[model samples]
Target chain A: MTNLLKNLATTEVLGINRRNQDYLRPLNSPSAKKIADSKLLTKRILRRSNIQTPELFKVIRTEKQLKYVDWSSLPKSFVIKPNQGSRGRGILIVYGKKKGSEQAWIQSNNQIVRIKDFESHIMQIFEGRFSLGSRRDIALIEERLKTDKLLKKYSYKGVPDIRIIVYNSIPLMAMTRLPTKESNGKANLHAGAICVGIDIGSGITINGIHLKSKSLLSDTYEPIEMTYDQKINLPIKGIEIPNWDEILEIAVKCQRESGLGYAGVDIAIDRDKGPMVFELNARPGLGIQVTNNAGLRFRLERVAGIKVKNTKHAVRIAKNLFGGSVSEEIELLSGRQIANLVEKITLFEKGKYKVKRKRKKLKQGTLLVKGLLDTGLLTSRIDRDTAAKLGFIDAIKSFNSYEIPKVFNSFEEAQAYIDKMDNTISKHEDIVRLAKITEEGKIRVRPVISVNLLIKGIHKNIEVIISTRKELIYPILIGRRELKDFLIDASKTFTR
Target chain B: MILPNLPHGIIVLLLFLPVIATIANFARYVLGIRTLGIYPALSLAFAFLLTGFRYGMIITTLVFAISSLSYSLIKYTRMHYVSKITVIYTANAIFLILAFTLFTQAPFFSNVLNLDFNEINPAGVLLIAVLIDFFVKQTVKKDWFTATRSFIETIIVSSIGFLIIRIPRFDLILVKYAWIIPLLIIVNVIIGQGSNLKLLEILRFKQIIVKPNPQDDKSS
Candidate 1:
């Protein structure tokens, strides 16, 4: 229980209760929710603001309108949904009129939806079964926008939408909800769609999670490389979403126009219409955080008090803080652990580092210490205190008794000191390798011992020079020699 | 501490509802298990209280079974929604009556005559009325699978509620201090105060939670 709470704090995982009390209830105004509840009202608001959204074809508010409506004049493809539907419920996508039947249409699921089926569905919507609190609602029909080819290839039959969670006009975190066969042509995580995390700086997708309908418990989601379709064997990992900057701009603008302090704006790409705003959720789903492998609380706390001039500036600020795919790329490809410049790593005792034991297997005592991923040095180094704690007592005692000079003013002086002490200190049985070192104007022979270290999640058996860099703050310094698997990004500090 | 002849169990129902609803809420918010709803569970529990557990359970099971059966039989027919609901309810009455008759006549259930269906108080009738409201909605809106799922969840919650009501210690304490009912606001306040992480969400967001934390080791 304590570990769970610690992990929650470490990752800053936001729960439903916390999200509602902290974010939604405080950040979202009642009017914002009022508009969000009514799809027609949201569309009108977004359209009036000149934000791009799918055009509204017709709205069936009364039974009389349904009776008098001309069925043939409707567009070839359109979407009919309840004005107050939640979680993508009570939505019907019509591909076109069915062959040889004027009153019939082909649905996204390839089922023939006749006029009777359509009317009955509208009547059901009017019956208030789909709306929250089961209140009576009208049906809003919008022109069905085709998924751009990039997203179309990934979807089975449904259109995909990118949800950008904007807080204080800054697009903080984003994930694209890709429709799957399991989702039944609906792009909802609960309905079994895949959520792929997108880099806030560049709209490139990273790792994703899929909640298959069989695993409806919401806790049991599978990490996925690609969508459910076997036809498209390509992974959806690095697909760059088109119009990403524009999408962010519009999403932030939508939040601004709606007077919502925090909101999730759904954007779908049409082959012609470009990126169109689909829906604005006053309370966005918390699953996006899991998809992004980021905690909303952590991100929210970051941009809480920052001021932005406009949507453009906010997008830039968001990109600058949360962008970059360095560690994400490594994780996506190989599932290797990600580390920052400074990290806490686990180190084991000297002989227990990685030595093979023929018998008498014993547990190695481990200690947590700070490490620096320095790019300048070729060989990694550990301090004397850290070495002694890791059972390198003999090596530390031997090096300490050598009476090494404290400071060498000249290069020749340091080289002479190193040449004199080489054979004596180098002959130590514990010293695995010898390496020259020059720092400031001082040069000293440091013992390189092989130590077992756990960085991020990867375990390494690497040689490190033992030195008392009393001036340095970190007990350990990891050089380029041990950082072969990771890419260094100076902008990032700590990754959890 | 016993009540002074409160007519119908509504007053008693009111007194006990806060505790039962909070239990349902805790099951939902903390444990991530959901019942049909809080009100329905409360009604079922009170119904169980007045009618006695054994007969109440049997009748509840029959009501759900008959509700499912009647809806399936008439669903394909060209009948209006209201008419369909009325027909299913009529079928429910007939089935319950027939089951009661069989229970009275069967040698195995010869003592069922003492189950006291006739002596049921007005509270029992009101509780059944509330339970029937869900039945009516199920017939109009839900399929057999979802209706059955809700029925089972409701039964589980109602059973817990029934057990709470059966405990005489709580009844004595609560009836003597009936003002304790309003004190559920404190419980509601504690529960309503969101923002603290929910227990179930810890498992739901396990990935984020368990993600390794790299200390902000800013040392050189």
Candidate 2:
């Protein structure tokens, strides 16, 4: 098992990671330049660049702002997010105003959260408990992006954002992060959002595209009703980004200013404003390799040591090397074969049997004995009734039965019979000698003899005091002493 | 056949004394305490363990008083970084000469401090060398406060280095788990990556503040 674990660690579950790193390392420059992370820096950069973002109604930075800011000023549709939060931990999106008062209603799962509850939730953000690294943070309220009609049927009350991996000033790959009910309306994959890679030149989605009929409002709880018929496709294919050239230019300028060789630029399109530079990332996630289903090591290695005089040259080089489109690569790599459902489980039992048959055969006439394998625990236990049932009735009678104490004393002398079936029983000693037999309208029986039992698997043996326990569900408890040989894999199932 | 190996033991003890003296001086002078002129204090302590306390203390006091008076006159002039270090060594040599002269003159001390000029000990010279190196580092740097801070850090680091060198048990364990060095490097890298928090303007939220007038701030 240890050898298996060592082998598993070395096995390549995914090949794209090694390729991506190889491609990125050469373009990466080591410099100490601070570019604000997405949540803080993107908002500032967008406003400076004259790009329209969600309207910020109010910011609660201090206790004064928290006290004076009017709740009534907030629109029915708004989003409250922590300014310094990451992985979408503290974001609340309000879908509509409640029936009574000026209170807002938030969609959490299938339920509606009241305005007071939402404010209390914001208090968690104010304390910075959910902030990145648990540092202090301020919360901001902004205008929520209305879910587009096309994507409305596919999502709950969540907004989707596009992530563009820009390396050395060129946009290499792009993906649309979609929020599912599973994602709790957050567009962060770490927060359960599904990442669907999109073509850079074209806006078509590559994987996990859901084409559903009903509007998002109707069935809030169920999975989006995907037909699997009229294949779900991204609507904006071949339609160039509103400001593609400008976005690329901003990425190049930002890279030069920040001195970061590799980066990711997140851009969102505002209904009124075209394309806004959302944020720039220094150490971008390697999951983009999985999204593109291409190895980054190969791409990174190809660009290594290649000097680019300008952004135009960099873009040309990137396009010439990694371009040609991913759809063809995906088809060629996967080979037109549908994925197999059965391949999900690699380990299978040889023969199939009904669940009922397996349970009955184990419980039928076998004597149940509970022992503590605890290298630490010093005892093993057995019930008298179980021993009698396992053809020990004659032995019990010769030892003097009816009463608990007499039966216990008689079984000590009969240790020779118990030793024949199992060799490890050393000796029988003092009986527990119970004063009274109390049963709630049930038959009471006691086992005689405290026996020393040796476990088959572990290094140590335990001397357990045996007694009948009728209420135990499993009828036997294997203590820690017996469990030394195996390391628990929390991901596996355990059955007796 | 085993002849007690007197020469080898003497050689090892000779090598060990300088390291012990420098460590003691580092703890006392740099960390701001007091100790006798480097060698006599270390030698007296070792001798007190070998001989009786009354005899060792008498010789130690006579030697320390003479060296302190000689070292006082040596600190008169300002010099360059390397020259300053030379001054410290010159001061120690003069102190050693004064101690030898005073010990020979004292009737009680001369009988107890029985050692020839040939046995004058290179370990004391090595200890003075360490002190000179430290003195040079402290005087040469432009930032006095930073230099002093580094001096304190050096003392602390060398103390740890000394303890690791002296203790065999700790040395063996560190040798066994040499892989810890690479693991520590990886941990430092992860810490470096995690601490980076990007600027607000780069994060793209635009509505937080109004534009600041740069001219007004400059004039004020």
**Cα-based TM-score, every candidate:** 0.71, 0.40
The regions of model 1 sitting more than 4 angstroms off are A8-11, A212-219, A324-326, A331-496, B1-13, B28-34, B65-91, B105-129, B132-153, B212-220
Model 2 misses residue A157 by how many Å?
Answer: 2.9
Question: Which candidate leads the pack in lDDT?
Answer: 1
lDDT score at residue A17, model 1, on the 0-100 scale: 77
Please tell me what DockQ candidate 2 reaches: 0.01
- Using alpha carbons, what is the TM-score of model 2? 0.40
lDDT of each residue in A360-393, candidate 1, tens digit only: 3434577777788899989988888888888888
Query: What DockQ, on C-alphas, does every prediction get?
Result: 0.29, 0.01
In angstroms, what RMSD does candidate 1 have relative to the true structure?
10.2
Query: Which candidate number has the best TM-score?
Result: 1
Tens-digit lDDT track for model 2 on A1-496? Answer: 3443443333222122232343334444444113434355556555665555567887778766676767777777777888866556667777767678575574555457765565565666666645654566788888777655544444445766667666546666666666766667766654445566555433455543322222211101112213221235233222234454555555565555555677676665555555555455655664554454443434544455678888767655554455434434444565532111111111111121112333533333333243322233233343445434444444445334333232323344334334342222222123323222223333333333323222221223322233455663332333443344333222212112
Cα RMSD to the true fold for all candidates: 10.2, 29.8
